[model samples]
Target: MLITNQLGQVLVQHVDYRDTCLLPGGAADKGESPAHSAGRELREELGVTVPLDRCLAVDWVSPDSVSVPAATRFPGEILHVFDGGTWDDARISDIRLPRSEITAIDFAEPAQLPDLLSPPDARRALSALRARLNSAGTVVLENGCPLAPGVLDRIGVLQTDRPSYRYPWHPGPAPHDRTVTQVWGWLFAPDGRVMVLLEPDTAVDILPGGTPEEQDQGDPVATLRRETAEEAAARFTNPLLLGHVTDPASRRGYLRYAAALTEVGPAQPDPATGHTYTRILATPEQAAELFDWGPATAHQLSAVHQARRQLGLPRAARLPVTELTDPITC
Candidate 1:
């Protein structure tokens, strides 16, 4: 099963017998179905109970194609990979490992999988991940690469118009009074809806983002990750630099902005922002209307829509607002 945590990290387990890590599944027992076997293995290995009916991919592996030593290899096997759903921090912490079989279990990012798992296992995990993100139904994998078209292109570029902020600012040359740099995430949910945070008092909705600090070390993506965690209480993975926006009015400096497409995670209370934000999911059009910042917000959402189009995903619909709440801070 392809089990992932809220951070979009895949669950991999280390076995004492093997040097490479493995996905949290094993061969099915006699008279057991693939779904049942997946669930049972997860319970036995990670102590987490998640449904496995959402099949993501099915790979038919040949015995000769298996990368393991011939002595340890079995006949060709048909692997049924399921979507294990996203787990929150509490659920992740609740994972109980079988010390005898699984020496260690941790969620590793997709990019890190190559080093963590065996070659075949890494390919299988990546195929599952790509399927999960892009909603490619029943992906067929040869080794680890998808046999179908449009499943491999993951990164997307989104071009935005000139940066414009809400404040009364004008463009000027260097040595300007203000040089603002902000980072934001274009986080997408499994259902293809975009996640937005609503301001409690003003009721204006915005993306999960904020200004970078001195400690950010000049990495906008890092700032995006940190600020997103603080403001929206969510974690994301495979953040590709979609693009940046710069204020034309600022001659000396500009409001340097960067965004990335992220997989949506569990939402919690923002530890840094103090105020608990109201998390909402909406389509690009609905999101454009929700933003009180006017054209700037509209442009940002447009860029996101274009990115989605580039990824071969369906356009988001004009859906009603869905709110998930948390504790409020004074």
Candidate 2:
């Protein structure tokens, strides 16, 4: 079974016998349906009873393709992965682990799975995540490779290595000596989903802001407003300074801010790129997932949440991130 938390982190189980973490499930008992076995495994291992109705993935594992102990004859198997739903903090805390088989549980970020799990397990978990995120129903895989790969799968989202930048939030004003080279803002919709720009070809996530131009007169916020408008057709207000990350080589600060979106117009071509960016309203967690910031994502999320509270926006519900089809101005 594949389980996730409200923050979209996958629940991985660490067994005493394996070096790599696995999704919280075991082989089905004879005559027992896969869904029933999923629920049963959760109860016996994690001591939590979660519904397993939604099948997220179906994978075929060939016996000859995998390595196992000589005593353990590996019959080829078809794996059915059911969704365990999103667990809140309170529910996560209620989980209990047995001392023997499933020794520990971790809510791992999707990008971290490559390092934390075996190659096949990592691929399977990532494919499952893409299925859930895109509302693709269920994905089919053979030997952990998706048979019909989506854009995310082809781009190698979870399989890509992430860089660990120490983007520690600074409460104080940005240093006066350092030049502000670039500005970025998290433009929060009324529902709290943040607006981000995606590259037209690669679908690479980019924060909706850019470098300060001469027309901006060295104001970082002005740069933010201009870039947001050009790249996303978005207008926002009450910009709250989140913090800045200093580039040691350049002695410059990349300013980050959060603001409430006031209006979003129809998509238009950006003058700089000559391409209309693919605008998306992603949950803060989803933004983090797409960016793959490693551990620094927590710091950025904490700062964004604080700004959200200050701006009086409600906490965003856990919904699949959506793309604006025909945007309307507010």
Candidate 3:
């Protein structure tokens, strides 16, 4: 058992057992809060009555992880993580490490901690917490130990204030409509160019898209096909499936599917409904330059572009973050 401060550094006790390694305070009396018990135990065992602030975690030796007495009922050790404490290395010299049972004490730096002992989730929280301390004005956010989702690419980047597919910031049960669906399309024109429509209110130039009908199937491929026929009055021969992206609106809760197609000719107005479209033909090179395919979309295009280029195949488009071989671009 090891107690770590808010910075994730272990508080070591110098004991007879070699005195270099540190161990956390063990067990708790009945009706004692984990944080309070740790403070009391420190006072009783070593006379260091350091006031604790928060119970960061409970380190219980799982039955599978360690050996423990079956009869003893304990919460193991509580990691009372804290900042603004007055205790220093000099005062610890007078403290007592009881010889009757447990022995020794010493402080351990964070880098020495094994990854196995500190889970990824725990390490992420600890890392973020430590980074905040280097900047005194930072707000230390409690990570709450979120579980990593199983599918897809590892989350290498982080956006603190960005929207999620679900309400990550406001986490709790809430009413949501399942009927709303996302519709996206790839409308190609005659001269190896594609139609890109800019949203009237926004600066984004994306493919024409709309919401799906209530009774329409939730499949994105079907929805994109429908939007193409209805909104642009264009026919697509073969629409290849691309990877999906989580909607930025709700992050974890919403999803959007992507697909591409090649066609020849301009989009026309729907004769049956008198519906017209706002469409313009643009080359893929122009698209890569004019439109930010979005970081999520950029990652997808990068992967696809890399694969095709490596195999020496004809590429459909250049990626937005494509490496520049020239000195000026870099």
Query: Could you say which candidate leads in TM-score?
Result: 2
lDDT of 1 by residue, 56-128 (tens): 8888787888766898876767898899887778988898888698998888756678788877777777777
Report residue 193 deviation for candidate 2 (angstroms): 1.1
Q: How large is the C-alpha RMSD of every model relative to the true structure?
A: 16.4, 6.0, 20.9
Each candidate's clash count: 6, 0, 21
Q: What range of 10 consecutive residues in model 1 has the weakest lDDT sum?
A: 154-163
TM-score of each: 0.52, 0.65, 0.32
Summarize candidate 3's per-residue lDDT along 129-177 as a digit string, tens digits. 3322222222222232213221000121111211212211111211254
Q: 322 in model 1: Cα distance from truth in Å?
A: 26
Question: After aligning candidate 2 to the native by TM-score, how far in Å is the CA of 322 from where it should be?
Answer: 1.0
Worst 10 residues of 2 by lDDT: 159-168
Q: Model 2, residue 247: displacement in angstroms?
A: 4.0
lDDT of 3: 0.40
What is the total number of backbone clashes in candidate 2?
0
lDDT for model 2: 0.80
**Pairs of residues clashing in candidate 2:** none
Candidate 3 Cα misplacement greater than 4 A, ranges: 1-180, 186-193, 199-204, 252-275, 288-294, 303-330
